[model samples]
Target: MTKDPKVVSFERTPAYLHHRAMLNRRENNTIDALELMRHAVERSPENREYRLDLAELLYEMGCHEQSNKLLLDLLAEDDGPSECYYGLALNQLGMSDVSGAMKSLKLYQKRDPNGPLLGEVARLAAELTLYESMNRPVSRRLYRATRIADRACEAMREDMPEKACRLFEKTLELASEQYEMRALYAMSLCMVGKVGEAKRNADLAAKGFPPSVRALCVCAQVYGILGEDELAFEMIRRIEDEHPYETERRLFIYTLGEMGLDERAADCARLALQETPYDRELLHVRAIAMKRAGADDRAVAGF
Candidate 1:
């Protein structure tokens, strides 16, 4: 008689899929990793670790709204693991909920005062107070638009893209001529997956009152998403040549990184570091670019 071989069933376990997802992430195959993570979550809805992994992946993919929901739900139960607070705080920061982020940071501190991430939370909390506060309404006609736009921005930062988009529409209704507001509304449209409208808004943005650097960055992002590479590159050029402010440069670098333009991102990081060698964020981007370009493991650690 021939010896019988043991049989294995890959479909029987969520862990197998989750492991594959992790491998995909390691290889930078984000689309496959995201889909695999989703399938793993579906198969094991009660697995806290699996949910956390999916949420982390979503956050990395810029789906902060969904990630925040998963993290918040996880934290609602017993909080033995201090990482939940840290993850929640980071998610809140991604969505621009600075107050909420700070609150979560405080919770993280309470849970684990010596947490490695406390430094990042503290830095964000400290910086929240120093933003260039948007000027208040100087005209009665613009007051309602401003209020709605502000609420929309708040919603966007809270990871409520649909709410933000709705609020932005109302803002546009009240002040159709508000170019800056329109640009923001365009971004909201993009968040909600209305790419065509976003592109139209981007086109309209160029004609109206000069847009803020942020608007240009957003427009470029929209163009990139729509596969209009030329327009996207043009927008980036405009940002670099026309708007060379420190804030603008950082935002530009961030946009390039998000676009997955490894060479350009590395170039921007290199140039930016020459000007501000101490900028940790640029250093981080440089490391990411190095890793994406298949540099040795030590390349990232050097940053």
Candidate 2:
């Protein structure tokens, strides 16, 4: 039950006339927001509220130069709101003008002593403190943990298989149960040609989330990688019958292709492609199977 578009437009128009910038931001209509506020500011240059709203909108839309100028003018004429100071501070931060951002932040703190943004301000302050301390000689335990994980992720990204495996070994000493970290660690081991350990971790993850879509898909992939194609196909069949969504079916089709069963893979890929014509990966498999079957023209067209 969607609402009538006409009714929605009519309701929004009146509210926008009063709080044009705020409403435009809520709707994510940046261009119309700029237009509406731009016109209002030109017509009533004396209206500080309209000018400030326009400035905030400009800041949100990444027009920092215009936004900073408008905020400066507003601050000169009147004591602006806490949000105004915060907006200006964020704009300065984006511009890498840290000194200006600090000044604005101080002003915001003074004006909004009991404002709702106190928690966020505290979090940001903590993050800034951590960022500043990242280069210091004194090593905190949390910093060490973050660094170990960081190196592991970087090694995987850079394709340094042995380094990634060593880093993951270090990470396991800190947090063994972190799913994403464990997943990456497992993948790195696999890439470095450690099939047994990768299978062990993948099996653990599969057991942890039995019947889950992602876990099942990963298990299917792991089995295929381990040359247990029959077991992988069995898992795929179960998942497809139990969860008939496009995601499961798609994984099942890809598993067949990964196992080199071109005929059966082609059948599944054809059905999936019919329903989701724009799926690039599915199209790739279809093209591969077509080429294998000596249908070069169809494969090229599919690609």
Candidate 3:
């Protein structure tokens, strides 16, 4: 039989508050969670994980500098966990401080060669290595902006939009007029459930690159998510009129799938399959659509 959860006792221990903070976070009460996290830190000033939890919460709330300070202070202690360096690396990356980010990542790798996060750190380090190709000097601000934007892309693809959006915010501060980056940042905002902000940012992107097929497709997706299906389908019609390439057409199909218009998604999938008959992504999407529509495994497999 399942046992009852432990009851909170009268003694208000730091660990108890920390446990409550985690529970609040799970319930989506971030404000309360943050307050409780702060209380936990105060009560257990010397506890590494308590302080780390507070710093992580601050990071999620976009307080990068403070988060970095806390993480760095933790690292300065003799018994610092190797994970503190990884947290510092994330903060540095969010701030567009690639040098600092790499330094921390390298330190983390050195300290924990076979650590659980080594694979992820190695991937980021490999991407950082690409910056070495700038044989000639590049503009510092622009270079940092691009590096941060690239890191944001990697973060989002890894399903960590909280980190990606924070980095993109820094990227835009440096290169506010980067149209493509703005569009990508809007997508990241969407991933983070900032729908109204996403629409505004996506609109900014569309205004910059009005006639680009890719921009319009993303605009349609944003509109679709904002409950303006008519506008989205209108954008869809515009893309169809433009007769974009097979690869570009995937964007529209993707929006259709996301909008729950599975029939239209399947139709577009079939049309795309006519060109690249064995395209794995399209095939998988087709199979998924079929499965969502109540198809049996055999029928889905046949797709």
Candidate 4:
């Protein structure tokens, strides 16, 4: 597997960066990918392909509006009728503009009737149509918020605590009424040891938002961080009280395990297994909990 030669001309700078970023993304190193993409953009300001690719990567990375702006700029350029329309349609979809996306998608198909992206375009069109029919405005808002939150979550996973905190803060500020955004902010704050602030945000989320499963889960996390074990258990019970599905039960159990509630976590896992019997992720977490509890035999059985 010989690699492409490094770009000497600045025009190749973006491609070089993009290739490096692709390598990072393949390795699940999203932070490194983002940083490399940033460097690529900086190096090749005039290459429209580079710019478009950067925008596409950002959109995929959960920075929708930022990517939308770049895609829009590309569409506005005086190029021949090209793939820019397809990019624009995707941005429309990202913004949850089903009608607009459909309109642009039709134009893209008409312009490039045999284009390679037809299948993908059609699939997204159908998905957006269903979403628009269900709840247009809410779908749009949720999509935008999810995109922003995904980037924040990726930053957290990459161990860039401060960057994740900033992204969470900005995302929450942008969607002040969004419970999930607030919850993520709280979780990020807790990760960075700002437990007091995390608790305040969690409390605000609990009060301001409608009864959200995510908000409640976040409240559990905050309480656990603050050493309010009883409150944390109570919060976990709030979800159980709702009769969570097996998947949700696993999520709650994992949260408890992550918070170091070994006994409670193990109990939740046991109950969930009676329903699922062999859920791999749940089994894995249960093994860890059992190990923590010094139930070596039971822990080994989980494997």
Please report, as a residue range, the 10-residue window in candidate 3 with the lowest summed lDDT: 129-138
| Candidate 4 residue runs with Cα over 4 Å from true position | 1-143, 294-303
lDDT at residue 25 of model 1 (Cα atoms): 92
Model 1: colliding residue pairs:
95-157
Expressed as tens digits, the lDDT of each residue in 261-294 for candidate 3 is 7877777888877865535567888888777767
lDDT of 1 by residue, 1-303 (tens): 998999986564799889999999999898899889989999998898999998888777656667878887887777645777777777777656776776887888787888887787677656664541344466666798888888999998999989998998888888888777777778788888888898899877755645467777777887887788999888787777665556577788788877777778787888878865544566888999878877789867988
Q: What is the TM-score of each candidate against the true structure?
A: 0.52, 0.40, 0.47, 0.52
Evaluated at residue 139, the lDDT of candidate 4 is 57
Q: lDDT of all predictions, in order shown?
A: 0.79, 0.69, 0.81, 0.74
Candidate 4 residue pairs in backbone clash: none
In model 2, the runs with Cα more than 4 Å from the true position are: 1-154, 167-184, 241-255, 279-281, 293-303
Q: Give the TM-score of candidate 4.
A: 0.52
Looking at candidate 1, what is the lDDT of residue 66? Answer: 76
Tens-digit lDDT string for candidate 2 (1-303): 987666433443433563775677689887777777887777778787788788877777656767888888777765555667777877787566665776777777787878877666656655655755675435355456557878877877888979988987777676565454555666677787889898787666555544565556656677777777776776677666665456566666666666666776677778877765544567777888766666768455847
- Superposed on all Cα atoms, model 3 deviates from the true structure by an RMSD in Å of 15.7
